[model samples]
Target: MPNPKITTLIITYNEMDYIQKCIDSIDFTDEIIVVDSYSTDGTYEYLLHHPKVKVIQNPFENFTSQKSFALKQAKNDWVLFLDADEVVPEKLKLEIKSTIENTDCAAFWFYRKFMFQNKPLNYSGWQTDKNYRLFRKSKAKFSDKKIVHETLVVDGKSGILNEKLIHYCYKNYEDYKSKMLKYGRLKAKEDFYKENYFNYLVYILKPAWKFFNHYILRLGILDGKKGLIICYLNALGVLERYKELKRLEKKNELAYHLVMP
Candidate 1:
């Protein structure tokens, strides 16, 4: 088989802190396309001046819509999606190039190592991170109905790569808090719309289960302080989602679902 060319796609909002490094890491790609959500943090300005980067400005929506827009802008048949906070290391880049050249699979998965302040966390349920980031553009697309965690839809065979993709998750507590709150609210709203609302018992047990599953069952304790922090935060996020769902249901203010698309 002939070596295939690939395009790198990224979606961003206020990701200036990680955007430059993320883009620099994927310099081997045939083309890099960034679809920004009119970021006010100068992220758009930086990409605008980069000679090798192509920038497109779009309004902020959910993750699925933003990524779907980026997918359409890709110029090559093989496309790799990278989060603004993710960096493709040299070893992974070489593996990716080699995979596209020899594999006929529709998509390839990469293990991700989540980083906290430049250190990797080998526990906290993060060690199991695997994402399908590389795929043939014609055979794959992101699901349209998701709000928080979006999934890719690949029409054919899939395979996995041995290298790890580095994810610079959050810079600090403030960053983590801000993102989790947003995610919690979005997930709650999605649950409300789907009529998956739960009662008090569920609200209480769900968070507990999340903590136990991630911290104890997943061996998050082995990772020490940072792992504990991650596990607790994960539980708190779950509680917040259920609380938000109940709050909206009590006031009968679920009209927001009508406006969401």
Candidate 2:
């Protein structure tokens, strides 16, 4: 078999439960490069022991920089950038191998099957969720300084893969809330850096709008309880984003006052 070697790159932080499963699914790759953010949950040690994995311990600054760094570390031009919480399906593996050889595209987008707390949400604004995960290292690059959804830029042509990647996104209630709050804070920092602060009115209206947009407009009602939970949590994440944004605003104000003598 003429193998077009692929370097699978992953950026992780404390993803102990899912990391091993994520790696085990991608056994077809040429080499696995795991960029871990000093995980204390035994994830780093496990990857270090794995024979096929080339584990690198790097401080996670943000998603964009970490992913960009991972891209540069790829030995092969064909790179499959995957999250530690996501698993490549069996069919996707075969599809990827075939497409990399047959297709002339610079990069490819893969749609995901979103799972939340052991349940699948068919709607809740997740119907068409997709990302450019498979791409040529030389052709694709990530947008700078985005804390979440660090957009990937493809230079040439792009296409979508047939099979969907399974994303075990939210494990439980507490876990989901913690993640949303953390993402909201990170996004707030990015916004603060870019001088994109919002007003006091946004604190209430934005969160309300997010819930309605997801649950009502996006047809989240169809997914039942799972959909309701997902939609509520997603809206909560948005609320946290604006709350953290205000926190940052107050923080800088205090610092400015203290420094002025």
Candidate 3:
């Protein structure tokens, strides 16, 4: 007749600025498990001293492996995978507490209200942005197939929370651009592993379509300047992805020729 205990899990690297607030927001959780990727910016030390936090310093690997490792460290059956840059609002905190107390599904999806430069982004293909943050550890897991944008596999039914998670996704344009470029490179590597091929035509179409789809079809125009910047950078990220993909193909070709007689 007692409510199930919950563990708030977060994998972080150089997230000192946001870590404190993130933890402060979720202090209601029964336990907080943080799997740090050997952060050098004093983030590791900060978490080490936090009484509520149990920090594990693991070598920097792909997102999938890191998250999967964090998932296993949960002491309770209910696990919430939270990003360091995200904060659980009071309403969301209350919602989560009540949900787990009466949850019927194996997992719960939380829609994120993304923030850019402290402004909430209402569109730009973000209206439907959701992640399976709250879930039963035994019923959900991070799949190791795609390393960068890792997929969460849920064995049973799922539910969606009414309150949106407040996600401070990007501090500024430069910050967002740098992260997206890195993501693009990682995505290219994933595609390379799968032997996915794309020609010159893809380079032109993908980025163009990305911009058009998000800005136009997704009603990003309503968000004005913020939406424009996001859509443009998103397309740039696609271009970066394909550019890296092309470079990878050429590198492989060169290696094959060198090895051949």
- Tens digit per residue, CA lDDT, model 3, 32-103: 999999898999999999999999998866889889888888989999889999999999998998888876
The lDDT per prediction is 0.89, 0.89, 0.91
lDDT winner between 1 and 3, please give it. 3
Worst 10 residues of 2 by lDDT: 115-124
The superposed Cα distance between candidate 1 and the true structure at residue 215, in angstroms, equals: 1.5
TM per candidate comes to 0.93, 0.95, 0.95
lDDT of 1 by residue, 1-261 (tens): 557888999999899999999999999999999999999999999999999999999986788888888899998999989999999999999999888877779999889989988998888888778998999999998886677888899999999999999999858887887787778888888898888865899999999999999999999999898888888888888989999999879756566666678
Candidate 3 steric clashes? 0
Tens digits of per-residue lDDT for model 2 on 1-261?
576889999998889989989999999999899999999999999999999899998998888889988888999999999999999989999999989987689999999999876577788888899999999988989988576889998899999987999999888888888888888888989989999977878888988888898888898999898888888888898889998899899999999999998
Task: Compute the lDDT of residue 236 as modeled in candidate 2.
Answer: 91
As a TM-score, model 1 comes out at 0.93
